[model samples]
Target: MKLTRHMMPLLVMIALLCCSLNGFAAHGEKKPEKKAILLVAFGTSDPEARKVFDRIDEQTRKAFSDVEIRWAFTSKMIRAKLAREGKVLDSPETAMARLMSDGYTHVAVLSLLSSARDMETVAGTLMKNIPGRKPEDAVIFMGHGTGHHPADAIYLAMNQVFQEIDSRAFVRTVEGNLRELDISEIPFERPTRF
Candidate 1:
């Protein structure tokens, strides 16, 4: 296989083809990890809470860069009842559906759960619905969690929500009295849940 005038260009072409094939394989091989963060609120019919929740949504977006993030009312009943009353809301289901349809692979849900009671259940159940998504994907739910409040139900509720979402996703609940907590010690952290 001595290099001749004709063979020189032929060998060069072969080398180029091999390099391109390698480049294509390398570039097309890895599937980038998908992620998103969602601020899930118990939602407000009060219209006043809407203003407060607006701040939460804005802050969460600024925190999680490169991760597709947005807001939603986790309480379908609250959202339904109020949306009819002209709150003009996007339900968590609707929001999640839009994100997934728009090519989001995972969504981290931050719930507006001041008191565990119905609010946590409302948010958790709605977030759990995120499981039946097309392909297996993660849906995170962050609770406002239990604090030094008189009632103990909030922590219990957060634990319950954690149980529901943990099997599918890496979930976390931040109650002041608990371990492994994140985002604790805020003024409105212990607000009365209506």
Candidate 2:
């Protein structure tokens, strides 16, 4: 077969394109972005409440071992709640800031607010201002999903925001919140005055 000038160039270009595509498709050729998991708990001074968050932290860590793990108490009000009753959170801020300064470049925050109200508002304010982090990428906040609370509607609303994966959003609450579908169904170990 006689090779024409145009045909010869076209064949070389096709070969190059094929090789590039195969290199991209190969596994281990490109590394997936590493992610970090942060579990945010409502600040609690109550011994029992501490246990609840501890269990939550443990479970979350186990579930996402591939991701770097971190924790934050996420709520000043909750810490105040425990303090007003003569209790103190052991390491709320330390845990939060340490995670920020540590090796993980991206941090996912999981809040323990019963209704996600505090996480969406108060916690939102601080997450925006993490000392050395970006609101859009560096820090992420996640909320525990409720399963038995009557306020399942709130969870539904939150689910809408957290659904977009590209955006820094999350949807979750304890299972009971969904199961009960009513606020009254939530069993509060310590009552809030407001």
Candidate 3:
């Protein structure tokens, strides 16, 4: 077969692709990589509220006994609000970067927030299109308690986003706010005190 100048580059590309695939196949089948668990939440400044977070941490540690666990706060506003009160917290980006730098190959993110947007972002980062690492193997996201706030329409919206990306993903709620909340029905003319 006669090879043209343009055909040379195409042939080289095909040859490289084949060689790469063959090399991967030659290494034989690999076992699933171990994963670390990252529990993410919108942290609080109140000492009393912090106990709830602590309890969640304790329960997660007990359940995932074999996995390495870490904590991250997804709210910059909440983090900043806490920092002003003389506390510091790590964001998901900061925590994940540190974990990757420490040679962690896989991560499973669990969000303690009613919303799934931040959790989805972390799951996306962990489950990237990298060679030798299956996206499904690297990460998972669990959104906790989609109720309790008047502004929880955000959680419903986020569930749709997760459904579009991964059918296995979902949102759940526990003990939602007791008050009947209908934004359209509520009259907002007067200033209310907390």
Q: Which candidate is the best by TM-score?
A: 3
TM-score of candidate 1 to 2 decimals: 0.40
Model 1: residue 162 alpha-carbon error in angstroms: 21
* Model 1 regions more than 4 Å off: 1-32, 85-88, 113-194
Please give the lDDT score at residue 126 for candidate 1: 63
RMSD of 1: 21.3
- Candidate 2, lDDT over the whole model: 0.49
Tens-digit per-residue lDDT, 119-156, candidate 3: 47644543454346432331223333325344445555
In model 1, the worst 10-residue window by lDDT is 185-194
Task: Evaluate all candidate structures by whole-model CA lDDT and list the values in order.
Answer: 0.54, 0.49, 0.56
Collision pairs in model 3? none
**Prediction 2 TM-score vs. true:** 0.34
Measured with C-alpha atoms, the lDDT of residue 161 in candidate 1 is 66
